[model samples]
Target: MAKPPPQPPQEPPQGGFGAPQDPRSGSTDGPSGYGYPPKQPSGQPGYGYPQPQGHAPQTPPPPGAAPGYGYPGPPQPGYGYPGRQPYGQQPYGQQPYGMYPQGTYPGGIPPQGGRSNQRMMIVISAAVAVVLVIAGGVWFANSNDGGKDDVAGTSGGSRGSEDGGGTDPTEGGGERPADADAKAVLQVPYPSSVPVDSMLVPGQWATAKTYAKPSVYSITGYHADTGKKAWKLPLDGQVCASSRHVTADGRTAVVFQERKMSSDSSSEPCNQIAVIDLDAGRKLWQKKLPGDRVYSTGLSLTISGNTVASAWIGGSAGYSITGKELWKSASYRGCRPRGYGGGKALVAVTDCGSGIDNEYKVQKIDPATGRAKWSFAAPKGLKNVNVISTDPVVVAVGAGSVSTTDIMSLDDKGKLRARLSLERPEHGQPKYDPNCRIDTESCVTVAVDKDNLYLPSEEHQGKSQYGDTNEIIAFDLGTGKPKWKSDAGEKRTILPLRMDGDTLIAYRQPTLDSGGQVVGIETGSGKQTVYLRLPNETSESERRLAPGYGTGALYVNGRLFMSRDSIRKNSTYDKELALAFGS
Candidate 1:
């Protein structure tokens, strides 16, 4: 992996109340990378522990633990722990209100649901300028060995993203239907059970009850396509969480939970595992994992076929759909589990090297047996290799330095298909036009659909790297050939949300660069077809938000439920979840 090229913060001010900003530029001075936290004691809360609300501010690891597993080295600094904001400090995907003048944001930010930040680094970098500049025409080839750069990670663990604002079915253009008269079903409001996380299951909406440790946590099944509540399954534990994706058959669910902590004890994470039958709305099997290894957060849970795997501080573990313990790999000798994906294997970091010349290997493990499936070693230059996505594609990035990045894309069979070099002259950050949110960048910013992949093509043009020249590049998924190139719109912007059949659902940033609109584009020709101007987006609290603020959307069943922060009653911030229904 090459060093991660600089990237603009996903949004100005990251989150929390703030004034509107003109943060379209890029910079190299985002959050510094590759600083991991120290290993926590089994009986004490370690770093990244969520402060128990109303309790003390810090917690240690757990108690009476067996010999720990692999190298659970300190967590690198690019991202953060869950259930809490970074607060006052900037993380990888976030930046202050403003920075440089040129921007192209692609990597770093994960798509909305991709929430993990651990992986070995295979970083690489090469540049000779006040800022690194690279030509987009030089197609890269994957190498088994490369030199490593400093500790910056291209798509490390920064968590922040763009908000999408689409309206109801009434605000349309040409012959398209309207976007909205409102952002919600005015007659019904979100239950007090405001969902902290949600997923689309076959014929139903599965939502995890909020994590309120020392109290209660649960998983609820809702009627499909409607707000009607179906079955609520509660658990007895200190904390609770569910996988973002359920089993392939959609009949089983895997959740991680923890035994509660005493008021004066360590605030350990969810260490218990539970597998449920969605159809029966009952627990099929449950067990407490061995040792003191702790799954970082909800992002660590991944499901491939009937097997589910989790990456942890002490090591990584895999489980059968029936909650049977398959294998648990111990963390040791600098080798540890970073994360698992690719639909068939768990990707782990087998090295904890430091500086510009450390050696690294991204190991693929069989989830069922914890056996080494295969490995991709640093060619000799790259280190701090973080492999983010692994299902539809294998997306791994190694850094060359803080300013230059080498991006490697591998197909489903672990074959390197394409490599790209990203950089800017002034060390400006990269600004993606289809401004991908922080979480979904890996497989989304450069989306792969069926036999083809779509990526943004931006050039230095004259001297800057803020993407003055932008186009959509469609490539053969396996061969990485230029099948077609389409104009992304001159001056205007296209922030693709997801692919809908032959069309791409995208949020078209205002042509004047002030407002936002949602439109649909046919992927074959890259032509705009359906359009909807969100009129109700500018609420009392959102009047001054930036382009990607105060918005979110997901296509469920047939309704595109666009979400926004509704101003909370009697509050200083507009922070309640208000959803708009659109066609």
Candidate 2:
């Protein structure tokens, strides 16, 4: 018999005081849930063993044992796990807090229910960066026969064009010199006195000249190659959210509170929106949102061409790049706009109905007219919808059994072309991690090119007795079939960052004795070339700063920038908020 749907956890108290326990720990020794922990002796506790509160401890599966089939439990925190207050209670569609909503946030994990599923999801550490610790590989084992039907188009062209425009650090210039030594070129310290709870600080962008990151109440631009601060733009209150897109000329948007919260008794509404010039480090314009309620929550922002869009639990609106109102959409067809996926195209995810009848619709919106170019209805009984790629129109949906069960690809007509199952009978439970958080369009570990989708296999015990490793696999978007697999050498695991022309630029996690590396994999030939290698001395810091499930990473020119998506007061790793590594 099918199990009943899990109940949502209780709403957490606001003001950061009623933060819930991590709930991810297994044995008392340490956190053994996420990532591939090394195997221990028979009597010792092993990795991947997760025990619910007051329940008997679970053990790892025996080596080479056929894994049992089960569904995914709630999202487990990967790295720098944010507190549970902002991530749970709300689910996806409901308006939990009104306009003055205090702690609701997107980007990582939906709130889990009280009952635990016997099933376990094998996940790597949730860094905005994917890290797999191993020691044996020098290069990806290239296969001559990878994608036989490689698609050709201009969509995945030069990195500069794909990402709006600016300057291409690697345009006329070839790759960075082979011997280029990477060191810490920039580092930002965490703010002091931040309550020991999760706070939104979610923006990171790079241009030819500047690398911009958001702090508590302001955003700062730093010299791309040097660590010097170029300019800082302060706001009246906290930065609640930031658009991942930048205009061709270097402008972007963010949502902030109207007034600063000065005490636990006071609250501010996250209804103020603004556009800023990343290069000049100044606000281009600011405006107030309409119909904000005192207790409403949930907001997501994105940019497509000349449109800057915002969606919440009750309504969604769009504005011109210069801040002129474009259109407003409220509840329609018993559904409201929840979020959007932008860039290359504009798409919206609308939540419809309630309870088991809950359904989601993905609509391709006309950026200027705010009309649906086409709409695709997702399968019923799904809990969340995450837009992975807008240009190709791929979405990740979680149904009754798994957090993310299927990845659906759509054609230009908004018709389903392929559906790739993450939970395969052969693999037992889900084995691939697209690394999507709760926010729409926040899948980080997955990338889509013209014809193929790229994702990392789950980390598992490698050849070395104590090490774990995984690989990047390519699948055809049209047929939903495997195209090729590129192993991440011996010890290290690699993740897709973005496509640079025909090459897929990826980051390789560091090993114990070495620093991390940025490599370019030629999609056609399956060739891998090291682009940048950090010094061995900074390996420790590189591990902590890598972007994966919950953070952000940007590779421009020859420089790579990594920063935390959200900040908490108790971070122990030098309180380093951001880091830039380059020669």
Candidate 3:
């Protein structure tokens, strides 16, 4: 409900496709017109299952209807996937001006309030334990410019006992020091000559032994504990789409182009899919989809069990991890599978029809056979569906004109349990926006566990006029009510990465003086624990990097990994390919 304290101007992001775009400032620069190609009458829902017999006739939503506004009524024919029917179309398209934009928060933290004395004591102990865990290896140096713009080795450098490179001179590639733990910090420099049109560098994965990410046309693994290059797997062309899911053994899938992109030519097709083992650093198998079809440059690739599924504008197909063809589903009945969400279960989101006739369906899919286990049809006129989680089954939906207005939680069957309103938070409450992308599973700022959904409150002005702050709120999945909320403390903001057991692992954005931190919030109690305190020395660098667009942040095995989603050619500023921090 308040604006952040005023701070120094942040440099605009270096130009490139999928470059980080922080939404806290309300900046609207992005791919034009919803970031998807226009669909024709015969066109696909850029991205289904079956059930029920003919029942009641459907009533189309009124013109200018928006979710949580004038729109009302349960999904027609109830919730199950519709069998082929002659249900007519309804004209719809009204934007909710209250919905927040997609992306990360780039605002100052707020002053502490609203917590009991007991909770304050718990946070204090956790902070002390974090410092003790890192021991003598880390320090928070003083900053003259409020910690903004100071490089690690410059005159205002905030690091202690460090060189300009952000690494010890004697600590070349070798065994990680026993002292290196979650508090350790390292950075990888950006590759030179990356083309602006290359479009994407889209995956981030971690193993106990290595931290791996795509750098332009190659995938490289770095020693997890020490910042040493372990292995690099070069590709024939730049990576286009990648699965955020990884197999237990550290293997993942990526789709790349057949030939290197040329600056003189239009973008190349992303037609080749490959499975790479991150720990061992080798491609297990690579194959091209059958037929040319001029596949959409942005294909949705995901892994569920041993099968890797891909969907695009033309159609959808499945493949084994060993590269065996499983099954393929072509468009049928004016509906096309657009993308997939993979994990504990495989799920697919399909778009059917065009314009007011357009409808989106979320289906629980069979990983191996390409059959629909069950399907849930979203209300007509809500054009986009982003699967936030597969197991408990949470989805964020919005109308054609906005990013997201509500979140729907469903049961194991295709029935909807509750719909959480994002467009209409309680009065005085900060507006909620997950900033979900067009893909099925690309809502990066939101996370869900079995019983509750977690999202960050939009940053607002703090009690002080000097800065802004926010909190993470959890909602009960069954009733769609607020369960608890946790603050990120003064001058800091936090985003949920994922679940580490019952604890919610979150990253506290760096401030002008303090480096970013890794925090664990107990789900039931809403208690906060500071697990890792990064070096104040590199706070400026850490502040410059926040997860948004194709870029991301991950915490696993006590290490924090961040990567720029893409790189641009002829940039005025230097940007790192990726940065890793650990104890």
Candidate 4:
């Protein structure tokens, strides 16, 4: 038969986390590529053991014979013996003691081919045994040392010394001393089992728990200064998703929930919104959505005194928090819906049509009354548009061939004051387009501070190189121009951009190798402080995963609550389904 063609080499997923696929072979169900072998059965002979079926007879050695001295007594008939001895000569082919001829056997064994095969075999075995012993010793040493080198390094205020040396106080540490004006804040502990999401009010203490018996999730407010649960209220159905929006005075908090089918069948969706008063834990009101609606992709309830505007996207409509119909529109065929920022004005975006040509429509609406403040068709080439912030300025991002990002300052009348455009390079050069062949363009995700905007770009290279790279660029809000660009060195899916006083807290889903690290980037100097780093041993599949943020506390309230999976093991569908429904 003709030889089969050689198979092409498989490529591992770049930067790691994704589906639980193989690293080397890209196989999801095959053996792990981490170099450890599968478990072996007990009592099975291993390595160099001889098979039992082979035919061989062994003659016992004489007393005091060394371990590998071979057979004693005399050689049997038909076996080669030295000196061509006749039968019965010197007692059955055995050489006479002290009369054995010189050169009869060199090195304690007759030559097989000018060299003693037996001696050669002994030497080879000894060498192999020595090598194995050394290798095992090295492995044992590393195991005892915990497999990491404690190299002398520096972090924060002090020099980090290795196990072998004392830290030098004169060397400048890699990290600056903690700001004397800043206080070391301790994060308050919530229920260890609760799936706490993003914080709505930072530095303030709040407690939330999912009550399975009543199929409702409740949020209890606590004074950040006092650490006491002030009030608790339950929403209407079991909450699959929820968020907390605080009133301007920071005294009142509105806990919003979307009704969904029981955990038994998550596919059965409902269109209802429930609101609870944070101070009294009372059900303020509940509104039935006007048609069969899927749960909202994004929900926000912002209050300006008595005027509260709740923004949600679902049921093919966008509505205010009071269950008042704001604007009814057709649902985007394949894209997820989003609603953001509701003060005097509201901004919403939805997929316009189907196919790859689909575009997003961004509209501004009056919050007091469901009135269209202004509407603008984002550039047709753009795929997604989102409002970054409402106060100071209103910035919206539009992704396109080279992501035409526009930052607009909207006046109270919804009139555009100043507009700034940011264009990402399609290729290293103007004419060479890498995404053209792949039929995909790069996307720019926006992160906003008070007067600075951070735009993260996802650039695609060809197959032979790193497929995607992340870059963050800072744009000045006043001039609407570029400030400084910083490369994140890894592809990261950014979460909500948060401001902790003057510090900006940004969460990113980093590429696989680094695990997921939440970083606090100083918006002033663009320096980053790692707030949290997950354990490195986490599987690549789970490490690349993102979690949903629900009602939680932020930094201002003296606590930060984040939800992430702590453990995952393979299981059957029946087992997983049962666990998901708490059965």
Candidate 5:
């Protein structure tokens, strides 16, 4: 075929796509223009343009576009006629396909140099949606009402009030005002008669005193703030014993001689618990037990609310203070039971035997109804066991080839929630030489205050020899985590632990001396205050001293009770000390 004649180059439409066409041009401006098509350049085709000879075939238009839309021209092809009107304007009343109606594009189509306007619109819509979601979340969080209900459900809820509520002080079911006739009264009773061996003023109570001649024993009493005898309970008979117990409200006094009996094998059997009403000189109540069981002098007598409990041994049958019989297992042969923290609950351990075969059984008892709560068989190799506390939970220490500790947590219904083993250093070579013939297997003393437990350990040589070298370690009762450890030295042994406000007063015995000493220590700060030596001097025939923070006084009945003889020896020479507190 003959080559087509060369044509002149054509100009692109003046207006871009989407722009209005000018009436003066008499035709649409863009690629879709109507009427005569523009001419092509030399070596290119005109109007309905065709490809040059040997040129590659061009791509077709999109499905909806005209046949030549998007088609690439030949290398030397000239610009073609404006294909159609720019996309913006259309025949009047004949809307452009796919274009939004007029006034829809308030700012018109966005600049098209980079991304398509449609893509930019989608991006902006997504960003606005994300911002709205964030704002909604923030508002919901700030307006939360859950915390208010939480506070209202707490113990302190009643103290809260709504705004504008009148200050009648009776809103929200608050307590009513006291009656006109209501009077503030002291629960404790005042002392009356004074004992002959009285030492200090009536405000002080006498814990214990020994007799030198005739019948050998001690007679102690509780005194009142007015220097009067509240109650006088004698620690007499051949098997005399006393325990330092505090009332639920923290009244300090000796719970002595729940029952008394003669040590002589020929004496009549007695089985009564003599509960001394310390503040009133009257007996609270004496509950008869099975036999003449007696408690050691230093054991803790626990009192919670109005119930008092202790571990006693004497009768053929072993029983708790609530009159419940204890299980007679082989594991509880030589061991004596002791109680901790008050409640209707108690923990006790009984010896199994000696050596590898040795074992102990720990029992939980309900004090209120005299019922058995739970029982656990300790490891077979344990040589000794001690019950620490039962309020927060029940914890016991077992000693054997390896010193292992076990803790048990109980719910209010006496159900075991968790059984945990406390961590301790593995048994290794003895810290002290093997030749050091000391009592290593002695029973460990365990005490608990609030949520912390204090365990007994040997004192090191770093501190004074007279101090308790073996020390007390504190552990979190709830989690069994260690809190702190205290080393007073080797000589000091924790006896009766008392608290005056936040101060901890431990009745300790110095190793250098045989008797006990009252050491005042701060609970929170772990600081020591007074270290008053107990009246245990050998040379002094008779002496009496008052210790502790408050009124340091010692009284018997309404009079001061003096110590007439040292606790050690009560030979024939000290006759006057015999009549001190009355045999």
Candidate 6:
């Protein structure tokens, strides 16, 4: 792929965790390994699961073993509550993302090349997942230094968490918006949602982890119907795509991002986190992930109730949204972080010299202190059982192979109560798209309620454009019994985004030619109740028939929120969003 055409640098305000560190330019004035503590093992010992009988002796797959390299095979979804669309924020100390080489798509759009999917996600919990949109492509790592730095606004570790003061502004009192169709909403400025001009470039949004850049990053609250920017709050780092949320209370938000720092000409990559108390319209606290156990802080940045937790290479740690360190621990040999149960339980994988041959135990720890309380060991063959959910006790699941997986629900005391099996896509199929479950053989896209668990079926295999069925299979959580299969088997298949109450919110494939509808399906039985056909641009790109650059539709309360962020087909990401809301 050719590099993007160079244009004169537009000097903008310097924003984010600090200054930009594009290693490609040979400027190494940033932090790389500073402030990081040495790795230490957890205090617990000899934690093992009873091996299952009659199964091939398991061992972690050898290097270069399987054709796939994503989140530990099938069944492992990017961490967090099963349906939160999160990527593990375990900060496993993976090398920093590479620079975007100079390249431009002939059509001004990146060519839809064959990029390999996110083959392996080594981390704990859910907070920052790469939404791998698997279309055809080679898995290449590169970034674009399309920005020039200038000092702007005030931020970085230098800013006090309480800088916003007691005078709050955005929406501090836990109140919803007055407009019936609009809920609490926020829009962060540029670089927050960078465009992958060419499809060949890995689709991971550069916005998720940009260090200091040319523009001051910001979050602006907007009036629902008028498209007015109500208020703007500045921050020092880019927001992680997987960990951005506008809560129901309308008063708070959690922003996750990666940062690089330098001391004495040596640089280190670190996780920059902040709690944006919307009411104050300023940050409550802004700090680097703390504690010796919190290595790789960005790996699993999850917010469960009042607590926020991070899993990393050194270990996993929990914190209060106010920036208080609640607990931390060092994970022993081969043990990996899983998910947080919000004051209920914290789960992690244990005993894996090699993930396969070993009988992996899934241990539940005290949410406050990282102390091992109980463990549910996997039966033989079901290696490396990763805990996925805590809302309803513990749902530990693992991929037996690329095509098969095992899902088991364990009781509070670590007793295996039920198990189920599901099918998944092969190594290089389109479903491997990060958007399709972060480029894994399978995605942990199951939606569970008090009584049932809903899982979307793989996009119908084979030729597109006809007879393709996109489905959500519902199963009883207690008995692991199949309930019903709801599908959108129409001309243009719809994508099931998430579960809202007893209904499923789905968006029809957007096209340049016509408007699209946000369809609401009944979870009990696959029935379409609400079909709101939106404006043409609600899902379409300004220049082509394809879906807009960062297009996605979510159903909130009585309104449908559609966001389209693109710089190619359109001049700016914000305009696309405002245009989509054209009333």
Give the Cα RMSD of candidate 1. 15.6
lDDT of each candidate versus the true structure:
0.36, 0.58, 0.56, 0.31, 0.28, 0.34
lDDT of 3 by residue, 1-583 (tens): 6533322212211121121133343433321122221211111211010100010001111224321111111112213322211101011111221121211111111111111111111111001100001112111111111111211001111112110111110112212223332454558876777664224576688777888888777898888879788999999887777888777677789888787766523346667889998889999999886445423332588887677888865567777777877776444446666578887777788666553344567777766666666767665545467888887888887643335656777778766666665532222121555646556777777778888888776665556444456677777787556767777777676777787557787777766666777787888867777777788776645644565433567776777788766555544343576878876
Q: CA shift at 528, candidate 2, in angstroms?
A: 0.7
Q: What is the TM-score of each candidate against the true structure?
A: 0.54, 0.71, 0.68, 0.42, 0.39, 0.53
Q: Could you tell me the TM-score of candidate 3? A: 0.68
Residues 137-238, model 2: lDDT tens digits: 111111111111211110121111122232222122224545566888998877776642345577688777788998877899999879899999888876
- Poorest stretch of ten by lDDT in candidate 2: 51-60
RMSD each, Å: 15.6, 16.7, 21.4, 30.4, 43.4, 19.6
Best by lDDT: 2
State candidate 2's TM-score: 0.71
Off by over 4 Å in 4: 1-236, 240-244, 249-267, 279-282, 292-340, 343-345, 350-360, 392-446, 456-472, 478-480, 485-496, 500-553, 564-583
Residue-level lDDT tens digits of model 5 in 1-583: 8533222112211112122232446542321112111211212112222211100111121234322212221112122233221111110111111111211111111111111101111111101100001111100000101111110000111112111211100011111122211111111211222221111111122322211111123333433223232333444332222223323222322233332322311222223444443334444444444333232311233433344444432211222323333322111234334223333234444333432233444555444332335544443433234443444445443322212233444444433333333322232211111010001111113344555544433323334432324344444555544544444545443422333334444434323334334444545544444344433342121211112111111212112222211111212222222111111
* 2 against 3, candidate with superior TM-score: 2
Candidate 1 residue lDDT tens string, 1-583: 7433223223221111111121333321221122111211111222222111000111332343211111112223344233322111112222210011111111111111111111111111212112222222221222332223211111122111111111111112113344432232211222343222211111112222211101124555544334444567776543333343444334344444464334422345556766665545677778765556453221244555556566544555667666666666544444445445434344544444432234545555555555554555433433234443344444434333221133445544444444443333233233222222211121233444555555554321323333233445554544444555544344433445545455556544333333344556555656554455544443322222222322334433333333331211122232323333333
The whole-model C-alpha lDDT of candidate 6 against the native structure comes to 0.34
Count clashes in each candidate, considering only residues at least 3 apart in sequence or on different chains.
97, 19, 24, 12, 43, 69
lDDT of 4 by residue, 104-183 (tens): 11011110010110111211011111011111110000001111111100111111111111111011111322331222
Give the Å error, residue 137, model 1.
25
Q: Give the CA lDDT, 0 to 100, for residue 108 in model 3.
A: 10
Task: Quote the positional error of residue 52 for candidate 4 in Å.
Answer: 59
